[model samples]
Target: MKIDTTHLLSAIEDYIAKADEDLRDTLENEGFVAASETVRHIGEIEDALEDVLDEDALEFLERVKEAEGVDEFLSVSWPDIKNEGDLEKALYEIFRQKFDEMFRSFTFSWILAEEPEIVEDISGEAIDTITKPAEAFIKGWSGELSRIMNLNTKDSMEKMLLKAQKKSWTIDELAEAIGDSGIRNHGYRSRRVALTETLRVQSYAQQESMIQNPLAYSKRWKHIMSDNPRENHIAMDGQEVFKREMFELTGRNGETYLVLCPRDTSLPAEETVNCHCIMETVENENALGMTADEKKELREKYIAEVNEEYEAWEQKFKNDMGIEEPRDDPSVTWEIYNSYYEAYRKGEIA
Candidate 1:
């Protein structure tokens, strides 16, 4: 089949534009939940375009003709190119990889939309491509379009963490390293707290319901809580919450006990940040070598610790926010309580 470069390019550009729009929506809404799906679909479309480009190698030859400033050149047939099939395959593979890389650039922007520190390093071409439709026509295909862009956002974050670790920096330092000044300054504390508390309540409700209603648990919460509790906490909190949980499973030989312990939020003035209290699990006698009964006792100890930590943190948050007294009415769910607390603290709802 003859390749249709114009049609293929148009389709690719259109898909890319739609992908960019979706990415923007994700950014504006802080919707990382939907980001990977959006990017995956865009990647699939880009791959199809690469296939079209491979089939239409003649269009590339036409570009070469224009580049050499010749009205016409010897028409190069597909077979005339050296190892044309392998060459076309290699070219398309390279093109697809490059397109994926570009898509990743946009994806990273979406990921970090709240903080655009990397924007300066992004290419004008990338920005333009994301902002406008691809050019109507282009007659050139010798070297690949070498846009200077980095798509290794995960690597960047890892490097930042490593640098911070080397310096023995705390969570506040780590947050700053990742361009999250809000975390450092406790600026997003309210939203972070609300999100964290909501997730925590949902998690607690699911777990309680799981014990009470195994069928409902199997239907709804089973898969969600499949991870080790600490990891599950991290996934739910994401970057919005910078707290950590440690789980230790203890039991006698052939028996199992669970204990949960949560570390305080590592941010400076964590109390002011309205951080969520974490629960840690301590397992008995399996690997960590604690007796089963000891594990149970420690679990209770940790719960007490968690409550004490939260009480202090909550008191400070209230003080900073100018909440003179804690709410006594049972009507105060954690979410409503924190929202009111945050508003009062920020002087928004006073």
Candidate 2:
């Protein structure tokens, strides 16, 4: 039976546009939570320093300047201040809770926007695709978020020491400088996370929705330029591919990548961050010249094949990354992600 997807596609487009528009507010709200934690952590660090230096910035500066290293001074005086793990833990929890909520809500809203006749029911296979990948996505992002925050802390501390040596400042002045450093910009960092991950989940949801859709046969890439547009993405506008096939994207180093959709976590941040492109699902006019029952049968068979392939890949990925299972406190690092991404580019993971 032929399926009319004109109305369904329109609804999908409208829903996506609305989601895109709301991204700014969503990011700001998440950023506010992160900002609150950042302020609290910075206050604690300042208090710890005061205890060690007796609120004498000049004395603290002179002692550190004479020490073998800033790290040595800090470590000897206030060992507990080195524990920026508190910030990492706080950020991870914020991201974990937000990601879980976004995934479920976005997926549900997308389904609800579909034409009733087109979406008879959601299947177990569809649920599996949605839930499993979302869990992995959240775990991976938590690790990534912590890594960035750790780097920020180290860099900020180094800068703080340098600034103290460069100028004659009171304790309050030094404290203010520390608060103004990059480590204290957790709210801005959270906004970046929100923008990228929101697109990630939305793209994943769109792809899975098309895969579960009996009438969806292909998808076309429609590139929407952000403030800064990627040349390759612009060149790929109107590019079409099979629903299950991957899009070939070229990196800055001229490296090639196969990604399922825009902002795919599998790709490096250079390619995925703040991407505004979209994949528009195309319905088969005649449903491939098959009845509804036949279409459903074909979809089921495809799902089984795809699931088997995916399970094997996921197992290999976990093994290669040494991730036995997802955990609340993920220790995965940026190096691990880069190594796996490199391996994937070389077709090692497949």
Candidate 3:
């Protein structure tokens, strides 16, 4: 039996787009809170630095004053001033705490609510399979956030110190530089982390739903184009593979690796960050446990009912909007289509 997937794909895409917007708004607010906390924590670290200026710390500063460049300055360690270690520990804790808060506020229940309509056939036992990947993603993402934050803290500290030495800054000036770094550097990183994680969760939940559906036979990867896209990901666009198989990609270091899905959490940030790819399922009618005639009757009934409902809605939309000139369709203009589609999805239109 041939199943037309135009409506299915379109519905899923529309649902995902709305979910992405909602997730982005929620996560962006959380990111603002995290960024503010990061700045406050950095201020406390700077205060600790001022309080620890004993003789040995002063000597370390003098050496830093005489140093030629960042490399030379870093070679002379301040054994007495323990703020660097303390700052590392503080940032690491902040990341872990913030990530946990974000995860707690997120919910996966909406994913399952839409599964029966979208996936068509999934037992209660199979529905539970969707959560396993989501749980694994959360664990992996939390660890990755801690690792990135720690590395960023170390790198920013080095840059702040080097800038101070080059400009002959006083202690207060150096502290101000560090404070500026905290505010300027972390704001974007917070937003980026929020966007990446939100998209990853949505993708994982949908893909797992497809995997559990009895009619789903295989999946295909479709890459989205954007400015400064990754060459490797672009190459993988439109590649069809079985649901259980992996997509092989070569890393920048020329090492071959495999990923089960586009935003696989086990992979590094380079491969997954800001990725806009999607996975679509290829369905098989034979797997539905129906005879040929029964399958044909079911398909026809489903398509006819959906088409009738959609056609009436489309005519009403065109008349209400007063579009006199004939175009290919109302969806030819994306802005108009999106507004009406979103309204319909929200049940604003009868």
Worst 10 residues of 3 by lDDT: 103-112
How well is each residue in 44-86 modelled by candidate 1, as lDDT tens digits?
5445434443344334334333432221121232124322344
* Per-residue alpha-carbon lDDT of candidate 2 for residues 1-350, written as tens digits (9 for 90 to 100): 99999999999889855754465444334321222323333333333323322322333344444555444555564344445365556556655665555565455444444422333465554533443334555566666765675556556666686566567555456556655654443444444555566566666666766766667788888787667988988887888888767778787668887777777666778887867677777888877566656765665665566566555666666687687875344554334444544555576755
lDDT of each: 0.33, 0.58, 0.51
Per-model TM-score versus the true fold: 0.20, 0.62, 0.49
The clash count for each model shown is: 15, 0, 0
- After superposition, the stretches of candidate 2 with alpha carbons farther than 4 Å from their true spots are 1-73, 77-83, 111-118, 121-131, 165-171, 185-187, 226-228, 252-255, 266-270, 284-306, 314-350
Pick the winner on TM-score between candidates 1 and 3: 3
Deviation from native of the Cα of residue 83 in model 1, angstroms = 78
What is the C-alpha local distance difference test score of candidate 1? 0.33
Query: What is the descending lDDT order?
Result: 2, 3, 1
TM-score of 1: 0.20
Candidate 2 all-Cα RMSD: 13.2
Off by over 4 Å in 1: 1-202, 205-288, 329-350
For candidate 1, the per-residue lDDT at 49 reads 37
lDDT of 3 by residue, 128-182 (tens): 3323223334444444444555456456556677676677766656645544555
